[model samples]
Target: MTDSDRERWDARFTGLGPGEPGPPGALVGREHLVPASGRALDLACGRGTVAVWLARRGLEVDAVDVSPVGLAAGRAQAPEVHWIRADLDDGLPVTGPYDVIVCQRFRDPALHPALIGALAPGGLLVISVLSQAGDAGGPFRAPPGELLAAFGGLAVLHHAEGHGEESLVARG
Candidate 1:
């Protein structure tokens, strides 16, 4: 991301108050897929909601985002989860062989390889992003089959592309 992009995200986060933490959209009904104990990573973890939820699920979690304001809000809500402030444009900082990895509502094709590399074998990956399939949207939205093609090596458990959103729940 450019300097302006980082600043924009920081400003947006600063303006919004912390919201409730919750499960990944794809894993809401299939909560059983969440491992009982394992390490997890939440990329672009705005306000650390999903990170906190993972911690509550009994996994050690490392959450990363570029916005310090968002990180602070996450820290306030879940002090137990480690919060790391890093620009993802520089690449992922957390050395992860994590059992679970999540990246929601963020899109950067450049980091796709790194995301896959961060996961351990047989690990679960839950990802969601804006898409153009269901509704005509802006350039940030994923084209059809983007998620499936990106993480195709993984054993796909669930994949959906519609409603201007795309989500995938898969195990590597």
Candidate 2:
């Protein structure tokens, strides 16, 4: 990301106040897929909602984001989750065979492979992002079949792109 991107995100997060914990957007109705106890990674974990939720579910979580302000907000909610401030433009800052990995509202096709590789056998991967398939086209949105094509090797449990959102849940 550019310097402007970091500033933009920092300002955006700085403006936000505290928020309650919430489920990962892609795993909302499919919480059963989440491992009962294991390590998790929440990439681009703005404000740490999903990270905290995963921690509450008994997973050791590492939440990564570029914005320190956002990480601080997340820390307030879930002190147990390890919050790491890093620019994902450099790729995932950590590597692991995690039992669960979540990336929400962030689209970086370059990291798709790394995400899959980070998953342990039988691990769950949940992702949600803006899409252009069923919405107006934009620079940040994924095209139709983007997720499917990138994660084709996984055992896809659910995949959909419409209503301006693309989401996928798969097992690795």
Candidate that would win on TM-score: 2
Q: Model 1, residue 109: displacement in angstroms?
A: 1.6
Give the lDDT of residue 148 in candidate 1: 93
Lowest lDDT block of 10, candidate 2? 17-26
1-67: candidate 2 lDDT, tens digit per residue: 8888878888998868756777876777888888789999999988888898899999999999998
Q: List the residue pairs that clash in candidate 2.
A: none
lDDT of 1 by residue, 1-172 (tens): 7778878888988867776889989889988988989999999998888998999889999999988889998998889999998988787798879899999988888888888888989999999999989787898998888999999889999998899999999887
Candidate 2 contains a number of clashing pairs equal to 0
